[model samples]
Target: MPFILTRITRDGLSRLMAKYVVGQIVCHERGWMDTHMKQIKKDCIGWHTFHSFRSLDQLTVGVMGLGKIGLTTAKVLKGFGCRVHGLVRTPRSHSSVEPFVDQLWHGREGLADFLKDCDYLVNLMPSTPLTHGLLGDEVLTGASRRPVIVNVGRGDIITEADLLKALEQGWIFAAVLDCYEKEPIPEDSFLWTHPRVVMTPHNSYNNNEDYKRHHIQTEFIVNFENFLAGQPLTGEVDWQTGY
Candidate 1:
């Protein structure tokens, strides 16, 4: 980390400083901590290990949706040291997370298991008719503990009420949400006011920008190279599933 040169909002010096630093500068608004007391509180807790925190040690991390981010997150957790469990509609659909997860559960039955005690349970599904409010009272109220409740998928999957109940009931230790049911989230929404909640503007792929950009560029480069070489293009598309 390097020194930060901050200025009053009216000075416009921040923008001037930004031009000079380019990617090196990371700016934050003033009174950021006041806006992030829950995180401040959650971080205040000392780090613990599985052996020490028996419950934490046997962390049964659950992923509600094994989509791109969810699958990748499960993989990372497994590699960094954690037991993973995944839930999806079809057992055969998600082979990417298979090796990382200790177990896989499907359908309502499998989804029910996600409510059980776990160190972390992250929802990385989407916001479709079938997924709306999916994490209602049944799953939210049933969880053994909050399990560090995190929702990176769509916000509406779990209603605001359910989230409140989970916290009030001690279903989980903390809440970290990147996306919410309402984009930009209502200024007065409880998601911000909740004592256990941590909110972000959906930056899960922050570190993947270069990889993403390269892939797009590669797609174009590959096709152009193939044309020059007189070779067939190599890309599959399943319009039916929209993948």
Candidate 2:
């Protein structure tokens, strides 16, 4: 391990912040801002449409990946009075999960059960061969709660075709997507016009304060200092796992 020199950046903080921001947007249904503005402009005071929404306390947020980012997200969501859950491949003891969430579902066999009652879903997994089309028709169909899918993870995890179908049929409530299979989503893509969807240009990890605070370099410096002092460095990469 000493043979390799690596650095820690704002990966964790960025992802953690992204999850919190996305969760707030989804839970508060802020995606309809444009539509609401248009309605307000259409009529000065006559036309009124009210939306029934639930508080975060009344909803369960399911995190698809139990990694650092997902765990941080879940922990933060807990502060907001929301119940958090994680999806795992197997029942394993994780320090991060213990303090954050009590409910966890295992693998494909457990995904359906995990999604059955979740009010919101957050994705933080990377794109991998085993993850391609992971959230397909069957998975989406199994989601009976009509949860909002907030994907800060890879876009390929949920095929656009299947996602569109799910949205059309109302299998899920809505989607808040930050990443896409296609980076610059095509100009003609229907998602751009989808009423129930909120799309960001893979900018979920961006925060203006990050630069002002020098967060990335600060993390690296702290980790480097710890390494020099023979203290355990945070955000150390595991080559075997490529994390």
Each prediction's TM-score against the native?
Answer: 0.64, 0.80
Query: What is the TM-score (0 to 1) of candidate 1?
Result: 0.64
lDDT of 2 by residue, 114-169 (tens): 88888888887766665678898667888888988888878988888888999999
lDDT of 1 by residue, 1-243 (tens): 332121122212222221221111111112233435545567444322111223222456787776545565666566645678888755654465678777777867667675675666677665666677777775765666556766766788888887787778777666777777778888889887776676777654333556545554566576668767977655433243322
Which residue pairs of candidate 2 clash? none
**Which candidate leads in TM-score?**
2
lDDT (C-alpha) at residue 230 in model 1: 76
Model 1 — which ten-residue stretch has the worst lDDT? 20-29
TM-score of 2: 0.80
Cα RMSD of all models vs. native, in order, equals 12.7, 3.7
Per model, how many backbone clashes are there? 6, 0
Q: Best-fitting candidate, measured by lDDT?
A: 2
Q: How many clashes (backbone atoms < 3 Å, residues ≥3 apart in a chain or on different chains) does model 1 have?
A: 6
